[model samples]
Target: MTKSVDSTAPVLTSVRQRTGVIELNRPKALNSLNPEMIDIIAKAVKNWEDDDSIDQIVLYTTNPKAFCAGGDVRFARDNILSGDAQLVDDFFAAEYTLNGKLATYKKPLVSIIDGVVMGGGLGISLHGSHRVVTENAFASMPEMAIGYFTDVGVAHAAQRMVGTRGQASPALAKYWAITGYRMYAADMLWSGLATHAVQDAETILDAIVENGADTALKQHSYVPDGEAPLA
Candidate 1:
C-alpha cells in the first residue's frame, strides 16, 4: 500500500514507505535539472527526512540514456541568449542549496547510476550513502567545457575522491575538469567514485524488499529495477 506523490510541473514522483523512491520523470529533457524540479526535490527530501516512516531513499531518473545529463542547459542558454544574466545566478543558488541538503541528508540514501551522470547529476548521486553503478553508468563533471565552474559541491567531493589538490591535477580530474570527459562504470568504480557495481538491478531491488529491509515504510512494499538504456 505505497503512497505516491506526483508533481506535474517538475516531473517527479515519490513512492512513500519505510524506504522511499524518487524518480525524475522528464525524459524529454534527458531528466535535466531545472528550477522547478530542484525546488520540488528539495522540499520532498526535507519532508521525508523528518518522517519516521521513511528509512531509506533511492533516487533515479527516467532517461535511460542519462541518469541526468546535467542542469537544464537550454534554460540557461535561453536566459543568456535573451540577455537575462540574473537567471543563471538564481538557478545556481537554488540548485546548489538543494545539493547541499542532499549532501547532509539524515537517512541512508542510494543512487542508481546507469547512464549519463554529469554535472548536477553527479552532485545528486555521489553524495548519497550508497551509490550503485551499472556497466552502462557514465559520469563526469563537465562544467568547465561550457565556460562554467563546477558547482553543486563538486569541489569538495571531487577532492575527496581524487585527494586534496590532486583533484585539480591533470592526471586526475583533468578528464572532467578540463574536457568534461565521461568515465564508464568500471572506471568510476576503479577511481573510487562509485560503490557497488550491480549487474542485475531487478534482482537486487526485489531482494531489498523481500528481505523486509524497509519495515519503516508504511505503504510501498517493493520497487522495480531493470536495465535502463543510455539517454
Candidate 2:
C-alpha cells in the first residue's frame, strides 16, 4: 500500500512498497532544514520506525542544485537577532534528536546524495547504513568557516574513522572537521564518508526495492553511465 504524507510540508514523505521515502523540498532555499521541516521529518521517521510494513527508508532532495545546504542558518540568525534564544535552542534540540534517531534506526536507511551536502546534510546522510553518491555529489562540514564547530553527529563518525581508514588517511575526517575542506565524489568514497558511488540515484532506489540493498549495490556499484564517478 502507498500512502502520501502531507504534500504541503517542507519535507515530503510517503510509503512506497514498504519503503519510507523522504524528499527534501525547499528548492529555492537549497533544501536547508528549518524547525518546521525538522518536525515534519521527525514525525515521519518516528511514525515509520516501528511499523512492520515499512522495511526501508530512503532520503533525497528534490533540489537539483543542492541535496541539502544543511540547517537553515538564516533562520537561526534571524531568531538570534530578535532575541529568541529559546526558538534557536528548540531548533537544534529537535534537529539533533532526528539525527540521533536515524543513527540508531533499526531498519536500513539509504541516502542518495548528489549536489551540495554540507553540515546538517552530512548529519542526515552519513549516519545511514547506505550512503550513495553520484558524480555530482560534493560534501563538506564547513562549520568552521562561520566560527562555529561542525556538529550533528559528525564527531561520532570521525571518532570511528580514526584507526580504520582503509584507503583514506587516518586523520582525514579530523582534518576535514578543522579545515572544512570541500570533497568531491572520489574523495568522499575513499574517505568512507560515502559507501557507494553510482551512476544515478533513482535507478538505485528502484533496484534496492526490487533486489534488496546488498545485491543491488553489488550489481550496480562503481558502474559507468556515460560519466563514471571519479573513484
Candidate 3:
C-alpha cells in the first residue's frame, strides 16, 4: 500500500530500510526550493547521517511535473523590492552550503531526476554521487537569462564533463554558462551532465536496496551515443 506523507510539509523525509528517502513535497509550487525547504533538507541529511540505521540518501520529488524548478526567486524578488536584503542573503547562503556539503558527502547520494530539473534543482542533484534520470527528465541552467551566473558547484561539476576524445575543455563549461542551454536525457547522459538514464524510475529504489548504489547503477544506467552536447 502506498501512503502519502504530510501534505503540509515542504519536504517529506522517511527511512526505508537502510535508505533515507527525501521527497520534495510542494507540488503546487513545483517543489521550488524555499528557505524553509533548504533548511529542512539540510537538517534531514545531517540527521540521517547520524542515524546508523540509514546508510544512504535518496532524493526525489513528489511533483510529477518538476523535481525542483529552481529556487524561490519570485519570493526573493519580492523581498528585494521590499528592501529586505537579509532574506535573499540567507537563502543563498543556506542553499550554497547545502550544495557544497552534498558534493563532498561521505555516504552515497542518489538523486532521482524524472521531471524538470533546473537552477537550484541542478545544484542539488548534479552534486550527488549518482544522478538518475528517467525518460521524462529534462534539465537546464537558464540563470544567465535572469542576469545571474550559475552557482551551486556548477563550476566544479562542469569541469568533470569531457569531449568525445576523453579530454576536458573549459569551452564546454563556458558555453553552458553563457547559453544556459536546456538538455534532455540523451544529451544529459552523453555530455556527462547526468550519470545514469533508465527507461523508468520504477526499479531505482529496489535496486539500490538490494545491491548497493554502485552495483545498482550498473544495472540501470545507460549511455547515449553521438557528439557531447557541450563539446
Enumerate clash totals for all models, in the order shown: 12, 0, 0
lDDT of 1 by residue, 31-141 (tens): 889888787778778888988877777786655677788899999999989999798889989998888888899987877776788888887888877677666778888
- Alpha-carbon RMSD to native, per candidate: 6.5, 3.1, 2.3
In order of TM-score, best first, we have 3, 2, 1
Candidate 2 vs candidate 3: the lDDT winner is 3
Cα lDDT of all candidates, in order? 0.68, 0.82, 0.82
RMSD of 2: 3.1
TM match of model 3 to true structure: 0.91
> Residue pairs in steric clash, candidate 2?
none
Error of 2 at 58 (Å): 0.5
TM, every model: 0.81, 0.90, 0.91
Model 3 / residue 115 / CA error / Å = 1.0
Clashing pairs in 3: none
Worst 10 residues of 2 by lDDT: 161-170
| Count of clashes in candidate 1 | 12
Error of 2 at 153 (Å): 1.1
